[model samples]
Target: MLVNSYGLNGMGIEAIKLFDKMPRELIFEETYVCVLNACSHSGLVDHARSIFFNIINKTEKIYTTMVDCLSRAFLFEEAQILINNFELHHSPSPTMLMSLLSGARNKKDNHLSEKIYIRIEEKFPKHKNRLVSASILLSNAHASVGDIEKSLNIKNKLYQLGLKKKIGLSFTEINGQIFKFRAHDRSHPRSKDIYAENDKISNELIEHGHQFDSAWITRLLDEDETIASVLSGHSERLAIAWNFVANPNTKQIQITKNLRICGDCHQVTKLIAAIRQCEIIVRDANRIHHFYTNGQCSCQDYF
Candidate 1:
């Protein structure tokens, strides 16, 4: 009724107010979760905190939801403190732990990352999911710090545990057309045309004083000669190749990926954005990284 009569903004405020008027003892875990989600959407940090504390007498699921909301908002330290002080016997759910680690990674807080890993180990030593999460975090943090060998070693350990990282891929929809590509994928029907276009764009960018940083490519390939070719096969490149083929003059491209964007890929995308005179929005595991012609990314290289 409120939405039909007053509209979205008014209805939302009215709904929240109505929920807030409920007696404290009557408020339930699901109610708290809903309020936490509202806080996340509306950026109501103080309200979220109040609701979180009020829900303390409720359930662990409510606490988990609060942790997730805080982490998603980049309040890693606060989330950590809340989780630690709760004295919950078991640690945060693996999903919550993953969110915390993701938030820390976004902030490039390796110290926090290490603490999270140690906590996970202590709390859930036999949990394979936590182990995989820790491995991925360590590998990514090591790679970010330029310790490529250590990063690869961490990945190798994960593999030994029978938990290899999923190959990252991306897909983009432009002008009602969908294009997909995986890391080093060459199975697309338009692979030949895509390569030809990528070659042309890469050459033009090089001529315009842009250098392709193929560090991730080098890490993936066993042979030195395959590095350049492999990098060209990355998902971002595939998206760009499709963009060129479908809409050569488009000013913006949006791509979504299933995993964290590699450091080298991040740098390369920024260069590509500048060279192509376009803005690229990449949604990865954590958040959106927007690249523009100013040779900068939205994350400031934190991820």
Candidate 2:
């Protein structure tokens, strides 16, 4: 539990220290998974690889974790090779493929995402849930790279099949209370102040030469929405805005999101931490991000 907590809090070194102090005889397959996950979350791929190769009896879960580490580093080729090697001794695992697909989506590597999706379809034809999830990632990969036509096509297909994309949400705590938000949410009593603060942040970011990259947006903007308006409405941004509104003097803010942080939001958070002279910690679906006051992130922009 300590190992996982340390990793999730961007303390990979501490997690590794704890792992090293553990008696080898007490180590189990799950132990390796936790440590490897720690490495993955903290961008310690080299350490993860060293630990992984030393394991004499590697389980499928162990292999998946290592693949996740490499994939998070954008080492797609290495990740795929590892997956291939895993299949040499056992059947293909949907989890490994999904990890690769998710990495591709994050990196906006549409080509690799397509190839992985094809492989997933061929290898796991009977796995309906996996297929739907793969399609979502594939579509997101396309949208991330500005291939909106392909993205729309996939979305249309999913809609026709009665499948829907999961709604993204974010949670944050301020003043001993928890606040939850969705994109463009205005249901809160302090909605006016939240949106006002968000607008203020956006204007400040623009003055800092932070261009709102429309590519990070996965869907078409509504008639009343501009790129800044759409991106600013992201659940994380709303949550962060709420923090400042509820506690104007907050020096530290923590957020938990249901989806991976988009590239634009990642960059924005780093800048916000620096500009606002605060510490921002975000735990996204994939990993944790610690944005320090110097505009540096613990993930080193790997995520």
Candidate 3:
């Protein structure tokens, strides 16, 4: 069955309308997946929950998608309650478990995360590959709360398994050409210029009272210099600086990230948008943030 593009692209209400018009017999797993995905990405918690319970037939993905929607909306208690209620009869899928884990990460509840890790670890034998990725997430969640020991243990386990965490990378298009950047990468010919621009942005933003979020710093550097280096070498920041160098007055810049945008990157993007008078849109794994020149973001800092 053909899935609705609108739904897949975050137009949840429009997708729901079309879903309602589809022939009941034609609606299947993909249809539900499309609508639920749109609702989740767009943070339509009510719509997602309503359709979840009222739909004709549901799949495992539908449940997981609803959890993702509620989590993205910051309804952690509600999401947990829903998962508990569902678990009364059915075992949760890996995706469903990860949705709950995402909620734990967002809330920064290290205790809850430890418990969640237990559940996740119990399923390790069956989902070794997926859990390898989830382990990095668990590690980050722990590290975000300053539980560096557990975080390192998780990463060390992945190392023993010969699995390496994929480095964060971001891409942007300028003058119709794509530019890619990774953290601490200085391979670009204009690497010095990008670092200089990032340094300027960091100092200015710091002067403006933007607090440094050191969680984004994955490098082992002197604590005093780590914040500056992290900010300078961030993939999205590098991409943004490159965009400015290539077209100083570009109205907007778009960057796509392979992982979630960190708190520091989010903070810098807002300030940079205002400072440069350029709208910036960054799409990460979980959501899209539209930073306007006024230093306000479309996600309202929820992400």
Candidate 1 lDDT over residue span 1-303, tens digit each: 232224433433654797889887887778877777666545566777876776547577777777777876788879988777655675456656766876676566666777787777777778886688676776566555566786788788777878876877899998887778886667878778888998887677567665545334314446654545666667877887888778889899999999888765787788778877899999998899999776667765546
Of candidate 1, the 10-residue stretch with the lowest lDDT total is 1-10
Rank the models by lDDT, top first: 2, 3, 1
C-alpha root-mean-square deviation, each candidate: 8.6, 5.5, 6.6
State each model's CA lDDT, in order: 0.72, 0.88, 0.77
Q: Which portions of model 1 show Cα errors greater than 4 Å?
A: 1-28, 89-92, 168-180, 187-189, 195-303
Model 3: how far is 291 from its true place, Å? 4.8
Residue 229 of model 3, lDDT score: 70
lDDT of 2 at 291: 95
Sum up the clashes in candidate 3. 0
User: TM-score, each model?
Assistant: 0.58, 0.73, 0.69
State the displacement of the C-alpha of residue 1, model 2, in Å, after optimal TM-score superposition. 29
Residue 82 lDDT (model 2): 94
Candidate 2 has an lDDT of: 0.88
Q: For model 1, which pairs clash?
A: none
Please tell me which predicted candidate would have the highest TM-score against the true structure: 2
lDDT (Cα, tens digit) per residue for candidate 3, span 65-176? 7777787676877877877777777776677777777677767766776676777778665777678756766776777787777788877888898888668899999878
Q: In what order do the candidates fall by TM-score, top score first?
A: 2, 3, 1
